[model samples]
Target: MRNLLMKVNYDGTCYDGFQTQPKGNTIQDRLEQAILHLTGETTKITASGRTDAGVHAYGQPFNFTTSSQIPLERWCLALNARLPQDIVVTEAREVPLSFHSRRGAKRKTYRYTINGNRFPDPFQRRWQHHHPVQLDIPAMQQGLTHLIGTHDFTSFASRRSTKTSHVRTIFEAHMEIDRSMCRPSSTDQGVIYTYVTGSGFLQHMVRIIMGTLIHVGEGKLQADEVAEILAACDRAAAGPTAMSQGLALMSVEYEESWE
Candidate 1:
């Protein structure tokens, strides 16, 4: 058997999530079904990690072993033809059999978007969280700076996570405001973009961090208290988990060159 790696992007609005579950209607289930149709082989595609329902992905990598003779270059087109309109196989390549998608990933980047408009924009509702109150961007940025180092992120992780260790290193964390998306009548807050690159994340970790930073923006929590929350190593110390629709898997990095 040969291994094939593929990079895919999906809207993720309708599916349950990335993994195949008993309930079905998931991104993995659809991809597996398409592959079974195209190659007549039942293969499991291992993604870098699973994103929650309603979370989109811009650059998700997965790999599967196949005995089929399909050319590597044609895999993307072939799979796209079989996949749903929302999920597209962006690229595919033949990889070493030893390569594993999830285990090989070195870092993952996630982006959380917020629509700061008082009235939610109809067009952006599916991909952004709507927040009517004006947020203090400077305070949020200050809070984000504290998250840029290796630390135990238990405060920001979901209690449902089964991972044994809560320690994770965050390489970069920042927020950007997209002024072009703001309405004239609304506060200059516009749209808020939170980007985080980390070694790995626990379930709902990014969302939880976003919620905490949002509290800082609202003056409910001080920027300096983020470090205290980290040291507390307690979930109750963190803010609520933000809505899932605003979160997206931005990209995955690997030490091994796929080229």
Candidate 2:
């Protein structure tokens, strides 16, 4: 059997999440169904990580073992033809049998967009989180300083997570404004956009961080409080978890050693 790695992009608005679930449709379920239709193989595919409902992805990676002789380019086109419009296989290539998508990943980056304005735009409603309150960018940046580097992110994770370890290394975390892309009439004219990159993230980690920073932007929480939350190691100490729609899995990185 030959192993193939595929890069997939999907709008997470309609589906449940990335992982397959018994009660609802998922990105994995649809992709696997398409694969079965094309190759008649019931083999399961492995993804780099699981993204929650309403959380989109740009370059999510997955691998599956298949005996079919279809060429790499056909895999992308054929899968896109059978899959729903929201999900698409952007690229596909053969890989060594030992190249596991999840195990081989070096780092993953996630981006969260917030529409900080009084009114929401019709077009960006599905992809961006809308908040009416004006945020203080400088204060938000001050809070971000506390999130950079390594720390126990237990306080930022959801209470429902089954992860044994709460400690994760964050390579970078900061907020900035995307003025060029903001709509002319958007309340987000001077709104700030938050971008974060890290080796990996805990469940609800990015959202919680965003929520906490929002508090800072609103002047409800002191910028230094972020450090206190991390030191507390309590979920309740962090800010409320932000909406999942604003979060996107930007990309997953695999080390050269894996190649």
Candidate 3:
């Protein structure tokens, strides 16, 4: 069997998430169904990682084993033809037999967009979180710094997550203002992004981080108080988990690539 690696992009507004679920439509289900329709093979596709429902992806990657003789160059075109409009296989290529998408990933970057206008932007309503207030940018930036290094991120994860270890390394964490602001005759300057690159993330980690940072901006939480939360390692110690729509999986990095 030939192993195929693919780069995928999806608008997560209409799906349940990346993994296959018995009840909800998902990215994996779509890809596997498409592959089965084309090759008559019930291929089990593996992804670099999972993204929660309503979370978008710009460069998500996955791999699947197939015995089809179809040229790798045409895989993307062929798959895109069968997949829904929200899900697209942007690139595909052959890879070594042992390459595992999730296990082999070195780092992943996530981006969360916040709309700071007094009114929500209709255009960005489905994608960006509407804050409707000036978030203290400097204070938010300071909060992010507290999470930049390696630490147990239990406090920033969902209470229901069952991971064995909560320790994760954050290589970089920062935020930037989006001056181009979303439409809405409001502040016309309420778009900002919080980006976090890490080896891996726990459930709701990024959203929780974003929310915690926002709390700092609102003066609800002191910037330095984040350190205490991290050390606490309790889910209740962190801020609210931000809405999933505002979060997007930006990119996944692997130690080596077939390309």
Candidate 4:
């Protein structure tokens, strides 16, 4: 059997989520069905992690062991042909049989986009969280700094998470204004982008952090209060969980190639 690693990008607006559910369509379901059609094998694929419903991905990596003799270079093309328009296999390569996408990942990066415009852009409605109220970018940036380093992220993690540990190390966290997508009519404002890279993330951790930061941006929470919230380790002590549409899995990283 050969283990293949593939990168996928998808628009999650129409699917339930990354993982398969009993009633709704998912990214994994579509990929498995495509593999079944192309390889004639009911192979199960493992991903680096799952993205919640309405959350998109720019670089989601997964691994599957198969007996098919398809050329490595052609795997992306084959899978793309069978997958839906919203999901595309961007790349594929051979990997060691021992490599598991989720277990082998060293870190992952996620990006959350916010539309700070007075009026929502029709094209960005599906991807960005539209917040009409002007945000204090400096305050949000300060709040993000507190998220760096290892700590109990219980304040930000979702109650639905089944993980035993709420402690995770955030390698980097910051936000920036994206002016390239700004409208001519809008002044002193641009799209806001929040980026976080971490060893691992609990369910809805990033979104919750975004929510807290948004609270800081709007003057509801002080920038320094983020540290207090982290120490509290109480979910209720944090701000609301931001909308899912704004979050996207940017990339998964490993120390070295498994090839």
Per-candidate Cα lDDT values, in order, are 0.91, 0.88, 0.89, 0.92
The parts of candidate 4 lying over 4 Å away from their true place are 183-188
On residues 138-229, what C-alpha lDDT tens digit does candidate 4 reach at each position? 99999899989999999999988789999999999888887776768765367898999999999999999999999999999999999999
Residues 13-120, model 2: lDDT tens digits? 998999999898999999999999999999799999999999999989999999999988789999999999999899898989989999888788898988776677
The worst-scoring run of ten residues by lDDT in candidate 3 lies at 181-190
lDDT of 1 at 53: 90
Report the candidate with higher lDDT, 1 versus 3: 1
Candidate 1 lDDT, 56-150, residue by residue in tens: 99979999999999988888899999998999999888889999999999999999999887678888788999987989889999999998999
Please give the lDDT score for candidate 4: 0.92
Question: How accurate locally is residue 13 in candidate 3, as Cα lDDT from 0 to 100?
Answer: 94
Between prediction 2 and prediction 3, the one with superior lDDT is 3
**Candidate 1 displacement at residue 114 in angstroms:** 0.5
The model with the greater TM-score, 2 or 3, is 3
- Alpha-carbon TM-score of each model against the true structure: 0.97, 0.95, 0.96, 0.97
Choose 3 or 4, whichever is better by lDDT: 4
C-alpha displacement of 117 in model 1, angstroms? 1.9
Across 1-259, the per-residue lDDT of candidate 3 in tens digits comes to 9988999999999999999988988988999999999999988899999999899999799998998999878889898999999898888888899999999999999999998876778877888998876678888898889899899999998989989999999999888887665565655655888889999999999999988888998999999999999999998999999999999999899898544
